[model samples]
Target: MEAMMEQREGVALFTICRPEKRNAVNFVVMEALEGALSEAEADERVKIFAITGAGDEAFCSGGDLHEFGPLRGAEAKQMLTRMGEVLYRLLTFPKPTAALVNGAAMGGGCELATACDFRFVKEGSRIGFIQG
Candidate 1:
């Protein structure tokens, strides 16, 4: 799974599971994130939503350019639009949210962290926007 969801102690923890790619965002990760958010929103037991990466090396590196590099004009546009909608929903979510920044968070990863209500960054972790 590109992402996984675990609910415990009233928190729904959404983890991006592509450590090999530095937890980079791809279509699969996007879908999984969206689904996790939706599920947590509807589940009354979940009072908090938290997001993080699989490994300690990176919270997230941003988009997987290697996976998306082949897209043409319309395809790229559609993907970007969808991701934007997902972020918008997260930003407006009713419940409190948290971003667990375990390591490096760059580009879109930085955006994702900001979307949450609060961020808990690990010691020595770095967060920056490198989007161009």
Candidate 2:
């Protein structure tokens, strides 16, 4: 599973499950995030949405370069558009949203964190937007 969702005490916690990849967001992760976000948004019992990563090493490294580096024209555009929509949804989520950055959050991961209304970072955590 690329992602996991757990609801506890009216809080919806969504975790990126690719610890080996530093919880990078590939297409699979994006899709899983979308589904999880939709479900959380629709559930009236979910008072807050929180996003995090599986391991302590990183909250998210960024987009999976190996998976997305070879796109040409239209394919890249489509993917970007889709990701933009997802981010927009996150940014404008009806309920409160938060990014719990336990570690590094680079590139798209930084964007994800920023989309949330609140961000809670742990000690020694790093976050930035570095386009390559």
Candidate 3:
């Protein structure tokens, strides 16, 4: 699994578990995030949703380029649409949402952070949108 979810004190924490890949978002990660959000939404006790990365090196660097670079035409569009829908869900989640940016947040990572209602960046962390 590329994502992990835990609940505590009415808060749901969703962590992207791919620090080795700079916590990049792949299809699996995207699906996991959607599932986690769905679970949290259905849980009445979950008053807030928080997202982060697993390691100190990066909160989320962006989409996994190596895995997605070969996609073209309809395939690429579909993937983008999928991710956009997931982010849209996060953006419109009923409860408050936060992005705990522990480190670098680039590209899609930045988009994810922006979708949240709140964003907390750690010291020395970097965030930007860089796509080619």
Which numbered prediction scores highest in lDDT against the true structure?
Answer: 3
Task: List, residue by residue over 1-132, the lDDT tens digit for candidate 1.
Answer: 889999999999999999999999999999999999999999999999999999999999988999787888999999889889988888988999999999999988998999999999999999997647
lDDT of 2 by residue, 1-132 (tens): 889899999999999999999999999989988998999989999999999999999999988888888976999999899999999999999999999999999999999999999999999999997757
How far is 58's C-alpha from truth in model 1 (Å)? 0.6
TM-score of 2: 0.96
**RMSD to native, candidate 1:** 1.1
After superposition of all CA atoms, the RMSD between model 2 and the true structure is 1.0
Question: In model 1, which residue pairs have backbone atoms overlapping below 3 Å?
Answer: none
- Model 1: weakest 10-residue lDDT segment is 123-132
After aligning candidate 2 to the native by TM-score, how far in Å is the CA of 79 from where it should be?
0.7
Whole-model Cα lDDT of every candidate shown, in order: 0.93, 0.94, 0.95
TM-score of 3: 0.97
Q: Which residue pairs clash within candidate 2?
A: none
TM-score of each: 0.96, 0.96, 0.97
Off by over 4 Å in 1: none
Instruction: Give residue 112's error in model 1 in angstroms.
Output: 0.5
- Full ranking by TM-score: 3, 2, 1
